[model samples]
Target: MPILRRFQSRVKFFKASEYMQPKAEVQNLKHMRTSHLVEPNLVGKHTLHACKRLVERILTHKEEKAYKVGIVGTGGVGKTTLAQKIYNAENLKGAFSNQAWICVSRDYSDITLLKELLRNFGVHHEQGETLGELSSKLAAVVWGKSFFRVLDDVWEPEVWTNVLRTPLHAAAAGVILVTTRHDAVAHATGVEDPHQVDSMSAEVGWELLWKSMNISDERDVEDLRNIGLDIIRKCGGLPLAIKVTARVLATKDKTDNAWRKFINRSAWSVGNLPTELRGALYLSYDDLPHHLKQCFLYCALYPEDSTMSRDDLVMLWVAEGFIEEQHGQLLEETAEEYYYELIHRNLLQPDGIYFDHMRCKMHDLLRQLACYLSREEASQIILEN
Candidate 1:
């Protein structure tokens, strides 16, 4: 009797264990479905020396419970690429318990941004929910965990207040990284100094150009190398410009004459740029203040790779009536502010060849953009040659 009762008890225990197995499986599935860790592929030899150090601090620094890092640069200056590299670094892989990247462009909607972010977290939403409700829920769920969030292409400061400022900030281990082209936006969103990404150097630009053409750098064909170096210089050390111009040149004759013709041709005659590069360059131009728009386009008057002094450029603007005399400010002073703003925004390069900050040069592709937009969009006045 005792043996039979013991066997019956064992049978009941086995039945209960079987019943819990499906529940355990369901719980495991639920846990597995919510993972949002992302490791992006790092491309190019960006060698972002400054950016890497900032990223390292983000990964290892435990001094702060939470913080925000700002990456500010002009479009196509490789901000996105640098951010991707930071996101995928070995030090960052296990640094955060959860990770998400979201694009918060100028057109981003508050509700949509929250919903997308939640979706990245593998959280589903009903159609009629309000932003407040979503934010509360997100904050609740993300409260105790370490969260690494990347907000790419942020345009307005309101994006932070509405979307991530409360929830992510409340998390004890949250680190929010934001990318913006505007210094104002960067300063508003960050608690620390924002890293300003600079244009690639001439050597880096040449490497990128050659890499785009699938050519080896080891073989130094002198004539072709000279023209290629000249082309790189004309590209103004902007990677996208070098890439677009190189891709265009790749389809032409392999000889130096073909490249020389491309270099010699007026930017206005180069026809359309690669739409990707054109659109990226145009956004920076489009964002300029109306009063400064013509001031910037005036840069196209100079030849590609030509350097002009700031004083000369400002004087020209004043002569052209682009600069209006403001109350208590010299026309040249106001115009110099415009020049510095352009340089600050990466629209113009300081003349490194002359090693003079007083001098500036327009990138050829940007010159192409300026000339094209001035003609097509504004019907800008053209002085006779």
Candidate 2:
């Protein structure tokens, strides 16, 4: 039970949500159409093509064949944005008899996830006392329904595999679309060939940056255009990063000298990040429960783009006293959970998982941020070498 407590420590107690409206009893909600309507605005040619392909597949599916499609991409490449656009498409709107959107974030639990699903379907705990009973109640609530579900930001395959059967791989003609940052998660959940979202092109990146800032595409403003392009270049084709940088530029002075000064200022000295991307990434980091912050920062020791061995990272965290033993839990187990949290939050990558070892990597921009944040700790690593 020590391990159980340790794992349960991470799962927040599932609370009744205000989002659960209609106020129906569990038996009444066998099918509910709860849709969190996100307004869809997709950009760039490649992104448009990806959306078109996915929509085309859904529209033409005439089989009992599985409709489990996985959209895989690195953090900030905009998988969620693409998913929302596809979900809101005209064809997709009437494709299923029922639909719901649930975000299974980094800190997630099957029990909590089930509760959320039941709540989304307009169910109230009019009676179950155990998880299995709750599960049975959930199955009964969703059983016979033709559903379109989106499990956004899935960090583990178990989230899908462990859910009620009809939610995925059902014989009925419904679909469950998944979005994740891990390739293995896609395969483990039965997605054979996942749609991989690559970074945007430089031209597309500049277009989005300027579009967000309401700047003209004309070539007349040569000085401003040149500086803006440099800023966009530093964004490295990441849509979220470029968007955040554009937000920062929106309020600033548009003079050539001001833009030049921002470009020349050292990201390290500012203790933030290049291109103003730190604000976005830092929100992800800051969302981590206090226990995992040090472990997340410890990742900076591995060089940029280097695949850090999962076991090695755990041991290093243990040695450095970053992981405190809790409720008779093994240090390694808590450390593993810490790793999963970081990956789930889009702060780390799951490169490969082997029988004996799991490999993880940090993105280049995130690595830059970690070093900037942990300057003193990173200097210790540099000195020991």
Candidate 3:
């Protein structure tokens, strides 16, 4: 079998319950009931707009042998979002003959990363090929072509220094964009001045909160505006916090009492180190229904920035007995409902670039929180190892 087919086979095997008897068959899930591609309402995203213009200028006007740029920020500060916007810009279409977006998360081996890059660039290689063989194949593919590539969530520098540098050395005109949390990684990728993404301002946070609430009435907006601003200040103007906080508030009755109750919650005033923004995330996690909690936490088992297939996740949930039974519904169907609920609550975001609603990725902060909450289980696994 070919490499891709074998990979699919392994995934199928992994999704099956190894020690349990066969269970009732559940029909494969169809289309997603709701879209999770909701664009955040960043009020006057001046920095983002300016960054796009800069990317265009570098890629279109620069005459370097191989142009590179980096976008660096703390997790949840919208580095990936900015890169996505630049990747899909309309004005830049047809500017390069080849383009690809590769998510290089914290856990990536050199060979696997190289293979993924080849796959995205429409190159094929045998399954057991050695590193040198793959490298030469990649070199041949980009030998004389103008290509644009986005490497998202880079953690280390070896991806370029060890694997990509030699292969891409001969490209006619290559433009590479990298998004990372570490300035070291950005600099190692040869970017002297990586664009830094900052948290939103107080004003922008309010816009995000109000937009997320989907509130319509001006009177209600005015009435809650003072309390809303006060509560948003606790979020520290982080977009992720404001958005998750809005989801929490949206569940309550739209009244001063409800908003006040949320503002007085303990999560809003806890930590100042690592991330003050995590308070909002904890609130969102706390708000999950019992069954959905298991499903949401289970997602943290995936590597950082990795996308999980909705189908495989639901099946695993069923196998783990996480999905509670509902009247007149199959377990898979019920599990699918849980999956969509997490997405609706913004605990899971649709992978907008690579896959549609069929796959989802959890924000790194949210994943960290999940792992923290499940530290006992993690500890047990560590001891066993």
lDDT per residue as tens, model 1, 137-252: 77877767787877877889888865677866656687777888898997777547888877777666666766666665466444467787887776666665665455466657
Worst 10 residues of 1 by lDDT: 26-35
Give one digit per residue, the lDDT tens place, for model 2 in 1-385. Answer: 2222222232222113222222222222211121232312346888778888988876666233446788999887878767877777777876776677766655455666677677767887644356676677776776656677787778898887776454434335566788899999988987768899987777777777677666764652454777777776666677766664665565567777787776665541334345544544554454455667777766665433445667877876676667877898899998887877666554665543244337665755577666666654445555766
User: Against the true structure, whose lDDT is highest?
Assistant: 3
lDDT of each: 0.63, 0.63, 0.72
lDDT of 3 at 268: 59
For candidate 1, give the lDDT of residue 246: 54
Q: Please report the TM-score between candidate 2 and the true structure.
A: 0.60
How many clashes show up in model 3? 0
Best-fitting candidate, scored by TM-score:
3
lDDT of 3 by residue, 223-251 (tens): 88878887778777677777788888898
Which ranges in model 1 have alpha carbons more than 4 Å from their true place?
1-46, 220-223, 268-385
Question: By the TM-score metric, which is better: model 1 or model 2?
Answer: 2
lDDT, residue 125, model 3: 65
